[model samples]
Target: MVATADLYDERGEELASLPLQLRDLGGVAEFSGPVRTIRCFEDNALVKAVCATPGAGAVLVVDGGGSLRSALMGDLIAASAVENGWAGAIIHGAIRDSIAIGGLGLGVKALGTNPRKSAKAGAGVVDEPVEIGGVVFRPGATVWADRDGVLVER
Candidate 1:
């Protein structure tokens, strides 16, 4: 995968939107996949369910309402995503177990890190268009992410 720095150089410009302060957790290789979207806040049960499906190289775009009060993704869910063959995950919130997530062979990006887990009240929607990082992610849309930020194409 090309670094965001390289992408910018090659593309001749940077995307107007998208969070560029995300940490690049190593271990996950660049994967090409379908796009799956989740709109929720703090809760990730729906995200888990979708990721648990037999993914054919699909990326999960999660909109956690940009809430950092609770982490939306942890090591367990990340592991589950890998086991389910998900290509990657882009969280519009905090993620816990950053170290463990970095060790898994999965691509992950989030606003920041949090140690607190989310409430399991089962609040979320799957296969929905989510707006995050100034981008509207629709289910089945093509999403590619590397160091140079995320690029989406219909």
Candidate 2:
């Protein structure tokens, strides 16, 4: 559970910092794990499906195309993540029910909050490399996030 600042100081050249000013919305302040990615836009069916599976302490990295018009996840999916043992979630988009999600025992970082939920078209790619904020979040890459920011390492 090293602080983001310390991690950066120790591995400044090796880690890639997520440049977006993501908000810390979950109860847990620090979380890190191997990356699991989803690439979609305004659809959350895959997000729900992934959260239902066993996380094995991995972090779900959702590439929502940086859209703030709709939410890709909410309280229910986040609760599922906790129940299934996901270490955390880093969403490159919006999320709803921020207040409720903040109470859950999961680490969630997102671009911002929105009240409108996303569609359930079930259209998206999973376990793929998703680039957000100039970082390519590939499957199996390790990600760490704290109040300072997120950092990724291959």
Candidate 3:
């Protein structure tokens, strides 16, 4: 992929940027694809379910309400996504198993890392628009992430 800086110069106003201070936690440095949104709070059942399916080169955007109490994703779920051919995962909340995920060869970005796992109450809404840190991640939105940052295009 080209540098986001160049994409900015080339596409100009065609791209919309996501404003967040996310950190990379995956082995891959860059990834892009249409979005599949998940809205949840301190729960990862829906995240697990969505990622287990074949992504077909799609990005999973999980809105955990920026919760730092528990991790919305971990090595197990991340590995499942990769095995199912997911392109990447973007979490609006914390995640665990940073070291394990970094070696999975998957693209993952999250606000931070936590040691605690989330609840399994089968909570959260899937394929819904999620707003995180003042940024809206809607379904079907294109997501591009590189060393520069993560940007969205409608």
Candidate 4:
């Protein structure tokens, strides 16, 4: 994968800078692919539903409203992402079971970890445009993420 810094250097100000304190929660530190967006606050039913489908090397970008109160993802959902062929997951909310998640091959970046689980109400919007850290994530855009940061190419 190309380094995000290099990509930034090449694109310069044209590239949208994704400023977030997302930690590398999964085993892989860097990952990139076409984005698939999900807008959900604290419910994870929509997230689980997406993880169940074939990812086709795409990245699941979840706009959880940066909620640290509850974990939008956990070990099982992350495992599903790996099994379903997702390149990575970027969550604006929280996740749980960091140790277990780090064991998986999937690339996961999130704000932080929480012990509480999310509501399973199946309430959320899929494939919607989500803005995070001054960056807008739209479905079908190629997103490059690495140790430096995340970038979006429309």
Candidate 5:
């Protein structure tokens, strides 16, 4: 994958740079694919369900409302994502099992870590446009991420 910095330079005006300083928590340092979004707060039922389905190299973009109180994803769910062929995930909230997730092949970027798991009330919308850091991650738009930052191809 191309570095985010180079993509920005080559097509700065055509991309929307995600403004979050997310950390790379998974084994892969970079990943990119068409967007698949979920909007939730302190809940990950939808996240888990979506990851269980075939990803076909799409990136799951979770708008978790920036909640650090609980984790939206953990090792098990991440493993499911990898098995289902997801390219990566960008979580706008917390995740658990960082060390274990780091050993998996999927790329995971998130705000931070927490040991507490989120509620499973299925309180979220899937495949909808999710906005984070003033950028809208619409389904079908390509997203690229690396150590530098995230960029949405427009």
Candidate 6:
């Protein structure tokens, strides 16, 4: 957590396919863990399920159809993730509870933040391959993120 460079160096060498030095989000905090992918539109019911399970050193990657109109994760879900020991969450859309989520000691990265919450129609799939920011994220892939964007390795 404190030494991102060291961790990156270690993982980077082993996974030569992973890109190095991605786009930096200024001083955005980094979260390290394996990738748990979710392919969903606006529903986050499956997301909640994955986050509620013991993280076991994994990051929840939710592909929310790249919608900025609604937030996929908020303070309530984020609090659950933290309490459940998730390493972090990478949403390919929007997230609410910026004030509260930012204060928590978790790795959170998304296209941006929004105040609108998503619907609970339960209209999404779990453990499916999802695309975000031009990258293909398959379930069980390793995801390392920091201020310097996100890196994925099988």
Candidate 5: 10-residue stretch with minimal lDDT: 145-154
Q: Judged by lDDT, which candidate is best?
A: 5
Give the root-mean-square deviation of each candidate in angstroms.
Answer: 2.7, 0.8, 1.1, 0.9, 0.7, 3.7
Once superposed on the true structure, which residue ranges of model 6 sit more than 4 Å away at CA?
1-28
Cα lDDT tens digits for candidate 4, 107-137: 9999999989889999889998999987999
Select the stronger candidate by TM-score from 1 and 4: 4
- The total of clashing pairs for model 1 equals 4
Each model's TM-score?
0.85, 0.97, 0.95, 0.97, 0.98, 0.82
- The clash numbers for all candidates, in the given order, read 4, 0, 0, 0, 0, 0
- Cα deviation in Å at residue 99, candidate 6? 0.4
Cand. 2 TM to true fold: 0.97
Ranking by lDDT: 5, 2, 4, 3, 1, 6
**Model 5: per-residue Cα lDDT over 44-127, one tens digit each:** 999999999999999999999999999999999999999999999999999999999999999999999999989999998998
Alpha-carbon shift of residue 133 in model 3 (angstroms): 2.7
TM-score of 5: 0.98
- Give the better candidate number (2 or 5) by TM-score: 5
Top-TM-score structure, candidate number = 5
Alpha carbon lDDT of each predicted model: 0.77, 0.94, 0.88, 0.92, 0.95, 0.73
Q: RMSD to the native, candidate 5?
A: 0.7
- Candidate 2 residue-wise lDDT, 1-154, digit = tens: 9998999999998999989999999989899999999999999999999999999999999999999999999999999999999999999999999999999989999999999989999999999999998888899999999999999994
Q: Show where candidate 4 strays beyond 4 Å.
A: none
